[model samples]
Target: MHTDRVYVVTGGTRGIGAAIAQGLRDDGARVCVLARQPDPAEGVAVDLADPSSVPAAFERVLDRWGRIDGLVNNAGISKVGPSLDYDLADFARILDVNVTSLFACSQAAAKAMAAQGGGSIVSIASMTSFTGQPERAAYIASKHAVLGLTRALANDWGPHGIRVNAVSPGYIRTDLTTDLIARGVLDVDAIEGRMPLRRFGQPSDVVGAVKFLLSAEAGYTTGQALVVDGGWTVNGYFK
Candidate 1:
């Protein structure tokens, strides 16, 4: 459906980002993945923690593809610890990679899209964006900021034919979640028991939502957060 379209995916080396990138490619879209250590074939090496690296990466995409039709801001990091003892540096670093660099990438993409007359931007938000979770203050804050920025940019760039949106995934089984589980930061059985779907989400669960947002099917949609959590955020009572 996305034949000939050029898209950029941050953190596309693994997990949700990898799924999204491959999904786009399967649909015939030309994809450029940005990661610290990239796949080399279609990947552009970038460290999202360093905002300065974002522009050049996008520039590389434009140089190669001549235009970018969509951008997925999926790169992020988290530091799990008590908020009271959380190092300020760690907090800042999380924000730098998750929020600041996302905006940097968006700005770069928006500039290119504006020149080309249109584009779509989909960011990977989290369920923590709407709820509070212990030991993830920085991550939660950065996700909240991501949603806010999606709304703000949608309003600001709508006139330029740009559509900005977000996808909020919950309890997905990825390397990040495995680490959280190993560290006792999350309990798999407890989460699955409480989740309405009664299972942990896989990375593939999020691919369809993201692809929809970036396609003409969602042409009229913007500034919205499409939740792919299988009812985790809406459940008012425990299952």
Candidate 2:
């Protein structure tokens, strides 16, 4: 059980965001999830790009729950293409959500956490940050920026009893990945051959990491990026 603590998860309607929210709820924590097309199931209606929307969204959670204990910055935008081919507007749009919005959310979360004496903020990063993935220039850049934000915040907030960190998933099976599969752009099953685990990751696999990172058990940890790639990034060959 989460002892009545609450968590706010962005992009919680589907994919990894929903999974993280569900995982925390299963552990008895209350959840508030923000995203576009506000789903009744999620209980939040904040647009990540609208920084002003974040505070009011957090306020709603506090109004209903009284306190915020954890935040998961699981929402982001990505554009894949040669960096030079990127339209100036499209490139900035990616940064708008993936970096700027997340940066704002983390700040809001920290403000609440500071008021409560301590808390955790978790961002979903990507393996593209560590290795070059062709045609995903904007995405890779944003993730690298997220990692940097995590580290900087960790150093500044750890002393204040707050932890900032990220979870970088390898190739995980989801609607996003499914589309790639259907397009034959990524072999959903074949790529598993390259991962040591011999399979794509499940939402639960990444959720487990979130649970641990936010739990009291990880009190001493912060500013670290946890890679949950099923061994996909550890090697280029052999699953």
Q: Can you give the TM-score per candidate against the true fold? A: 0.95, 0.94
Question: What tens-digit string does per-residue lDDT give for candidate 1 at 1-239?
Answer: 89999999999989999999999999999999999998888888988889988898888878877898999999999978999999999999999999999999999999999999999999999988999988899999999999999999999999999999999999898887899899997888888878889898888889999999999999999999999887889887864
Give residue 123's error in model 2 in angstroms.
0.7
Estimate the overall C-alpha local distance difference test score of candidate 1.
Answer: 0.93
Candidate 2: count the clashes: 3
Stretch of 10 with least lDDT, candidate 2: 37-46
lDDT of each: 0.93, 0.86
Residue 135 error, candidate 1, Å: 1.0
| Residue 195 of model 1, lDDT score | 82
lDDT of 2 by residue, 74-99 (tens): 99887777777788888778888888
